[model samples]
Target: MQCGFAAGSPCEVTCTRVTLPDLCGHLFLDWNFSFAGLIVEEGASEWQLRYAFYGDGDAGWVHVLVAAPLAEKTFPSIVKFVHAADWHEREAEDLFGIHFEGHPRLGDFILHDDAWQEGVEPMRRKFDPREAMRHRKPDEDWRPHRIVQEPGAFVMPVGPKYSGVTESVHFLLETVGEDVIRSTPRLFYKWRAIEKLAEGKSADEVLLLAERFAATTAFAHGLAFCQAAETVCGANVPPRAMTLRVFLAELERLRQHAGAIQEICESTALAVANAHAGICEEELLRISGEITGHRYLFGLLTLGGLLCDLANDACAKALEKSQKVLSQLNALEKHLRVSSSFLDRLEEVGIVPERTAMVYGLLGPIARASGMVRDLRRAQPYLGYENIQFDVPFEEEGDGYARLRILFAEARQSVRIMEQAVGALQSGNVRERIELRAGAALGWVEAPRGGAFHWVRLDGNGKVARYRIIPPSFANWHGFHLSVEKFAFQDFPIMLSTFDLSVAENDR
Candidate 1:
């Protein structure tokens, strides 16, 4: 698939060596027009690297998966693949210690909170993570990101720690007179070495580990982890389990979306709107607890099936609750649209251009808000989503208002999806463990934020030899940073509230 720059615009046909990474980007310049982003998975050894590229297409998502074994531990960096590969490549360097020979910025990223000592790569299987932490040493070469200082420019440090909704992230903003020149992100303060933790554990045990990585969408994470395990082992999930998984997952999405809207209102000082949306969020969580036995919907899924059959008429109850909450959400949205002050605060703030969002394949509501019609649930259906119908909403404006509108629209669709899934349920067995084979595969889902991807490598005994979890937060964090560039410093809180990111999820 080698293609070189014939003209400066697009490639003529297949060319030769892609060894020069710059050519990789220049070669796909046409693809970048529609290119979303890609997720990289290093195989059992350095023998192969599997990539799932959701690149250029009519919907801005040519969702396809392919694998290519590399000839060496080092492969040419694809910083040229898309404008956003810069961050993904750095992540590879931090986690697997892969050398991205020409990456502009390659150093400690997510694990920057003194989580590990210098020269320690926690995500690698051979390294003992505990030992890496015990041997922690300050990086001598680590220095504050250098940027050309404008007149009156000064470095402003926000936090690597917070006790509120935000996770542990240290933001170093270069600003002059309240105008941000650049925002440097220091993440992974809560990095628990998740991929390393999953190693050597059973698939069942891995579910528990994976769910904790992203607290808000625990069900989606659990489902993705189990799906990878099931796919590698050729296990079959029952019909009832499929429908139930969809139901619980939508419930998780509803709560997150509702909460996102509430925060957006709060960020604008719209206390009345926040109160109304906050009540809806609490109600959604209450009903989730009533059905799943956990507000986060944990402990309900297992490999091949579920922990147990869902409560009798659980579907009917969920539909009833969803309908009520949707009504409340509709009211809240109506109020928000007419609130001139609130709309003014959100409009044109934190604008993320369509090209930027598409380049990152920014997942979930964020990408949808940017007019990118790429929802994994629609593009690649899993867990009975094929039988359900709902609109994949998009907006031309990629601002805080657009994001807030997406939260409401997605919540409405989630209710519709759950209603259909509930009515389509049929009688079936729910639990049975399957004998797994030694292999590897990727599993993912339309998480609250975006797609939560889990790549699993099982050993001969069906034990996890390696695990990689890339949640939506990790993928979209860059998009958030990009949106805030040159924006006023005061807009930081508003932008952050609309992004509604889970730092715990990203830092992992």
Candidate 2:
């Protein structure tokens, strides 16, 4: 059934409350079990109650908040009803401080303990950051630890520095013989607080910060942030810009996925496959630079529309290069798939089941590799993706091999999308001058990792009020825990790298 809520309302009240089984049944019918949970987000004030219905899919999840004051007495039952939505409830409790009476695990989801005083809610609107900082100290207790072991257990640590020149992240692996007992990831080493710094900047300025959230997915972040800003201003982008945005977004996917597949090859000691994949990635990056003047495709998107129009000839040249690069990459991927050594390392390593993926709300390639058919580009269409045709890849094995194959398949699909988008590109105005308005809006884009979300609110004078960015890395971090449970210590690096979790994106 279609929701009857109007566009302008902050919340919509759904009188019907179904049991978990019935809710799951409804989700299966409509969104196809993409998401299966309920949550509650209270208003800023003490008395206002709002409930949210959250659903998960292989691609991403959706949240719809209902307007109504939640009865304090009923909060416990509500919390228990959606036990699978622990992270969501914990986040709501931490930010809004709306107690989930029966919540099994409720604590700070992101904030360090020293970052906020005990019993003080750091994310609430009324909490003063300066005052909180006064009481805060750097949390040195943020190190990773493993389980106590008998004779067979071993501990392995991978990187504050890695083999490749990449961002800094560390993984702690615990194993007994060849089976991994636990894996713990340590993040926040690259925390920039981009959301906090964006407080007083103009929407345009925040767009710059958004682009830097991740080097690989820069265009994706810029696109999502710009869409949020445009939504807030009620500005409509020109069709040409929209088409170009889709083109760049797919291009970003191609580059990132190519890099991922190459890394997987390198991990499995397949030198030939790795070299071939690396060459394809460099070519993809070069094509990005040819099309947008930046290898990473940053600064192409702005608040109203594109920073500048694309040259038609440049677009054509980039398309031709991409087609050639993709063909070569496809041949290499097929060869790697048949290689016994590579298959041996990936086939059953770092397995994450469909049920666990759902509990952790894995997104993008990770969730797709686990037999989940979720693709935000298809599920919640934006940036002309609704008009474009593509398939959501899925793997039933849910192992390192599955994730690797998914990335390879997605790279091919992204190339297909780029080809179509480039063919349809028209020579026309790329931007429409839009007047800024003081309002709030939500924007989301399917970044290479998963869904990158931006919530932008503008002040009366056209300045940013509050900017909340929830990158895919933050949501998928839970998958690390789920995947590491039964894997061996040596497999941790491959498993971790397979997800390609971006610490910079998560820390921001």
Candidate 3:
């Protein structure tokens, strides 16, 4: 049934597989909605594919559901109309063996062909993890696909393995000369299947998995999961708890942006700038540890609210230290702007056009850097963000410098938000007792890199039945190649550092 929807309420409509693409196009292109994420779930006899969307300004969410029969598990691909569904379609196909009829590419997505067998379908009901592990075989005939096919063109494989603490992600940079003509990223080298693991587990058990999946953005993901669970159980959070949630969220954002700036500085060989940014990042981590008792703010978020109430003095102290760090970040930004060498490498290199960002559904800072002013905190205010006063920083240039400026701007704004949240703190219960019930809901947050969406469904026993995470890195990774393409090979790392996407987030 189709119904009028409010900003937070979802209006879901059931449609046949035949009219799936047209309906998706109608809602997305004609109605002007942003493709949020595609969620696929297996039922008793059929597969349900839900196409989720969110709109700007006063608009609400619209979900299109298509049921593909088990006899012939197939559905018309919506990638031709909505380009953002590319990776999502591939992931569903890989895990469930549900073929998207017109999908251009489908195999070797989460389950890499070189490592996993062809028809394992780990997400299927009949499949067993131990059984699959006992009989493992790598596809020896596997070869990386190439797009650039000129006389002197050759593909340079970067890595599924790299030096330092970087996660495994192979990059196929196809080039004819000095310029990279095509760039293909092969991620999910370490797919932990967190979603698959969440099946049948209680909400509390799954919360632990959610936070650990992406350590860098732990609080954001954990909070999102908690929000979904709270919504499912119809739990109400106290105003003070809501205020603290925003405060902690901004703290994570502040630290993440500082780390991003540090990486960008290191990428451009700015030794002093790198050290200064790193120092700021370390200080923020220390502050996080002092406040939440965890360096990454884990073990703090629960079903309806926070695990513990933060003392007023602790909040004040953290805010003061964060303000000093912001000032240092501002000084660093000013110095980098005057540095000609840094500007030359970042100014126009790796540009993602505004239209491309919109079509690809780029989220968070990456989308904002391209002049797309879509932030969930402001657009769909949640967790007391509606009461907070701050600006959603954006840039029209969409270059490396634009991305860098966004990081700094957002970091400053995060401090401003933290101040407001801390000043408004009240003495009360930080958490509400929530009795779990069977339901499904979507929870979202504007993380440091971009918007992170978590869709969760609970069984009758209050255990997780279906869990889907669409992290900012996963959404932004699609458009990452657009920036790398046509840019010189020398600017690759600099361009990548600007995005600051998490490989661990994608692998999950």
Instruction: Give the top-scoring candidate (lDDT).
Output: 3
Q: List the pairs of residues colliding in candidate 2.
A: 34-56, 34-57, 35-55, 35-56, 49-69, 49-70, 58-374, 59-374, 180-487, 180-488
In model 2, which range of ten residues has the least summed lDDT?
50-59
Clashes of each: 2, 10, 1
lDDT of each candidate versus the true structure: 0.75, 0.71, 0.89
> Residue by residue across 403-490, what tens digits does model 1's lDDT show?
8898888998999888887888888788777998998767878899988778788999978987877788877887778778788987
Best by TM-score: 3
Give per-residue CA lDDT, model 3, range 1-508, as digits (tens).
Answer: 4545555578888888788899898877788788889988888898888898888657767888887677778788999989889999999899988888899988978877777656878888777655647334665676898777789999888887754666788899999889988999999887889998998889999999999999999999998899888888889998889989899999999999999999999999999999999999999999999988999999998888888899999999999999999999999999999999989999999999898998898988989999999898887788878778999999999999999999999998999999999889887888889898998999888877788889999999989999999898998889999999998999998998999989998888
TM-score of each: 0.89, 0.84, 0.97
lDDT, ranked from best to worst: 3, 1, 2
lDDT winner, 2 or 3: 3
Clashing pairs in 1: 25-80, 159-170
Q: Report the CA-based lDDT of candidate 1 relative to the real structure.
A: 0.75
